[model samples]
Target chain A: MTRSFVLAGALTLALAATAACGGGEEPAAADGRGPITLTDTQSHEEASRKIIDAWNAAHPDEKVTLDIQPKDADSQRQRLINNAQTKSDAMDVIMLDAVWTAEFAANRWVDELPADMVKADELLAPTLETAKYRGKLYAMPWLTGTGLLYYRKDLVEKPPTTWAEMKETCEEVLPKQEGMSCYAGLLDKYEGLTVSFAEAVQSAGGTVVDDSGTPTLETDAAKAGLNFLVDGLKAGLIPEEGITFKEDEVKNALQSGKVLFARSWASLYGTANASDSPVAGKVDVAPIPGLNGPGSGVLGGANLAISAFSKNKATARDFLAFFTSREQTKTWATINSTPVAHTVLYDDPDLVAKYPYLPSLKEGIIKAKARPVAVKYGDVTAAIQNAVYPALTGETTPDQALSGLQQQLAGLLKQ
Target chain B: MRRGARWFAALMISPTLLVLALVVIYPLLSAARESMYVRGEGLDADGFVIEGERFVGLANYAGLVGERFVNAFANTTVFTLATVALETVLGVAMALVMHGVLRGRGLVRASILIPWAVPTAISGLMWRWVFQADGVANAIIGEKILWTTEGVQAKLAVIIADTWKTAPFVGLLVLAGLQIIPTMVYEAAKVDGASAWQTFWRITLPLVKPALVVAVLFRILDALAMFDLPFVMIGRGKFSVETLSALVWDEATQLRYGPAAAYGIVLVAYIAAIVFVFVRLLGADLLADARSRKGQA
Candidate 1:
């Protein structure tokens, strides 16, 4: 049915090719009385469709059509940036990765949200802060994510509280669980590696790059943090193949009962507990273990922003407001197990009943640190991944990797 | 009539020429221009751009002397050499088997082309799964090795995947060349009491040299621009498999347009120089043959 609708639309366009401009004016009024196109990363297409459906039902005159972008955050940002740079108004509303907010807002690619549109007091502060460039808000915080330690609840009576304990625990338990590894995470050389490394470094009480854009991976704490990975692989606590594992691979490994402990996003909990999962009802989530205790997690979320060149700014803003409202956010949390920016939803009796992880997720979001905010964050991420991945995979020593990271990040930050 | 034919031919080709100019030449020239100017923002906390613009001619190129660029360059060169060499040998061997008098020759030929038909991105994903710890690669090797973790293993995995998907393309090209080789040449060699090895090396090899040389040159270009396979098989930013194309893409996606353009210019220069050497070394005759064939066509 969707295919036929698309086909019919295409045929209409083909037949009206010469008369396109004649009919295009009525729907593109300046007062923003027409349909608004909202672009979202395809990861949560169903939830987005449901939200759009609800919004359309509420406002028949101002329909919101969903435009799904690539699942990869970088590609989604680049596509939006390209469109914005070219001054094309193809997308009125765009979903932005938290880290990309600074870049997009600084370039004036996205419009600053009206001050009244945001209730800072109602949202998780750190996640809300990601939508701001300098002091003004440019985006509306929507979905928020944080790293969680997933462990076999049946195998371990208590989740380890520190890296050392986790390692010792893994070593002790490997013999009991056949054909299974101790732990896995997003160790692949990409942004996920950066997130994983950030959690590790912060767990050891170190930082990769501070808010001032200074390279901070030169301390003992940082070295120890990085060594958690190197030593784990070397000690055979973490599988050697885990170095190549991304989010899905780690999830699959944990879900299939192949790994005892794994680190992944909060979004994976529902999937892990699904009936089809081999370890369903046998796995549990906790704060990612640090060198000493619960470590910091890298803040991951999507924010909604109106394109600067949007033809229907009013409708776009309205749609964004409705999409991230407290009611809609609660619905999202209940339906998709996604953590929304609204703090009220965390304490909502209904949402808490549906998602037991909400309280923990709130705690994670409160403490989660945003990745280094820079116009060149993409380059910074690449540099960190390039320098640190080798060591994580045991191809380079921790010292060498740290020094390389320091030098590369230093150079990148200088530019 | 001749003048009219020339005019019609010129008119026929002009649209294609215009399209090539718009899509290819225009971007190349604009990118070259962009390489000279840095964006407004330096690495500052506020991170604002377009407030001020500066011209820093060749500064971006000079900054490319870092370990990352060098590593990417080396990886690309090694990937090109390794994949091209393996593909050539394997391709020729397959072409030989397919050229032989076998009852299932057509089936064998069709089967060899299947891998080539798979999109590179899809093939890369398939190979990534195959290289996973408990994947088919480990099963076949009788040992578990993380194919995309260590430098050597990851690089080798990419090479193996590239060779698998592309060798058949080379084989088909060589097969086309083989088909054109008259049976009389082999018959004459057989009648003269030539051994199998002698016939293969003396008669068959030289005859297939032109096609193989062209194949290698094309493969060299293709392998150097390899982005999808390595980008997918082993995730990006790994020094072992990051190609120049990947570096350019990484830079471009970051909106470092000037540096990306610089990288693009550098890649074009590198590929052009390599192509020059390749054609001078082995493809001069192949080029001449192509020219004569074009004239005939």
Candidate 2:
């Protein structure tokens, strides 16, 4: 009986293996062309799906499908890297964070765009710069984001132009408004912290790392920026919980009417203005406060790239161009509050009429700088985050933080 | 006849042995081998020499001694010890409660097991929401504690979530152990005029020791390698709650394959040493019942 049981088990296993093989490649399309799968983060999945649907309807011969990725950017990047390393054809079109361009290009995971396909003059210069690696375009800028200072319009008459003024204003206004904290910022020990630090340094008229990937944090401007955050947290102008806030947390604090001011991306504007928001009509946005003047924001956005291993590269590239075209991009920008990289959208009267803050937001996007692009960007950003986060948390002084950051970045680059 | 039986036994076990080698032994050996070689960023160049993989000896292992990895290892050890100890104690109490004569015993058993049946990730996210600054934790305490941001608070939050999700498993094991003890043994102790406390100490504790130890061992190993619960509860890059497994994951994501493998190798060795000490020195005989029962039969 036991021998028969073993024989039956072996036979079942063989049958199961053959059954699994039955699902292997079948003709999925009426035309010979296969479905083009575009993988992007879940944040913009709805907008991406709408565009994909439009594209599919226009060209039924080559259908495009949307694959929403993890909500966290880090996880999405890791998944893309894993797929590329394994030479998997699971992803055809990929949405890459602006900082991933150099690493993806260096790894030869993305196909280089045709020269004619890269219309540099039509897109924002800074946004377009992120899609290029070593003078060749490997990705297309889909959407653009820049940090903006959101304030309770009912409380503050006009937004503060400088960091010191903002602090004084918050101190003056917070105690008067019951149940209100002074400020909310994203100071978590992650990529958000890196973005915040870079914006701060740029707003202080200093560059954390120059275009050639040199650590420039030794400058006084960088020190000033770090000091602004450190001193704010120490003085309680920024709440202690600010050190733990990510974009969502900061938005929650603002929408819940807990903070007088918040520093966040352009995406939060729509959420805050939604009818259900506690302070929906009470909020207004302006350029982020700077040390000497209006703060320069950090350029935050994703770029679309075709996978080198994709069997449908032509369809992927066509989808990329169609998605970023002037008409489609305008439609996307209106539906989703995402700022587009196409310069024409910023000038469109209809867009400006719907979103009154579009002009100032456009200026902020223009002034913002991209994170340091390098082959070892992951290590570089980690080093920056480790150093700057402590300073913001009041564990170390700004001078010490910048020096430590400088040393760690140099070591990482050398490695 | 003995030689032929030995040959037949070996042939009978061959398939399982092959599967064990493929799934378990092969990966372990490959990780150990890969730990010695370093690969740089940004190339899929194949072969050991061609892909910039250089034989670096113990350098990769040495890299595992970084402050971050050390802190993660220390945190993992503390979490394992604390969670396992607490779970064992709680499990014993729970087993006693369930073993006693009580009304609605089925309902209590089913209700207690619901926490364990909930997926770890789902439970973790639920706990994360509860522990938020504006959430129930602060509401109950009325002190506005930053449960996820502070180091101690974050560790305690993870521990609470882990304990809530896993204590029921230990309780189940101990309950099974309790059920197996014959009623006549307790009756004899009662007839001998032994007090309830005396009977529990002399009869129940010693009899349940084997199952409790085995449960503790499994829990210790599991808690040490925990990743998903903490990852979901308190996001990443926090030195306070990052476990050794999470550290390995972080390193792997950064494309540091050799260092990640080294971490895996070290973690395996550490778990092995722990299990060895538990079974060999602590006298936790996991297979004692099977051997003794077979002998009796």
| Best model number under TM-score | 2
In candidate 2, what are the lDDT values of residues B198-224, reduced to their tens digit?
Answer: 998999989998888878888988998
Regions more than 4 Å wrong, model 1: A1-31, A164-175, A179-181, A209-220, A393-415, B1-13, B43-47, B51-53, B287-297
In model 2, the runs with Cα more than 4 Å from the true position are: A1-34, B1-5, B41-52, B289-297
**Fnat of the models, one by one?**
0.42, 0.19
Distance from true position, residue B266, model 2, in Å? Answer: 1.0
lDDT of 2 by residue, A195-305 (tens): 889988899999988866678999999988888888878877777778878888899999887889999987788889889898888999998989989999998888899
TM-score of 2: 0.91
Taking the tens digit of each residue's C-alpha lDDT, what string does model 1 give over B36-134? 877755535555565545788998897479887898899999999999999999999989989994798779999988999999999999999999888
Per-residue error for B156 in candidate 2, Å, reads 2.5
> What digit string (tens of lDDT, one per residue) describes model 1 on residues A51-105?
8899999899989888989876667777898888667878999988898887888
**Interface quality of candidate 2 as DockQ:** 0.24
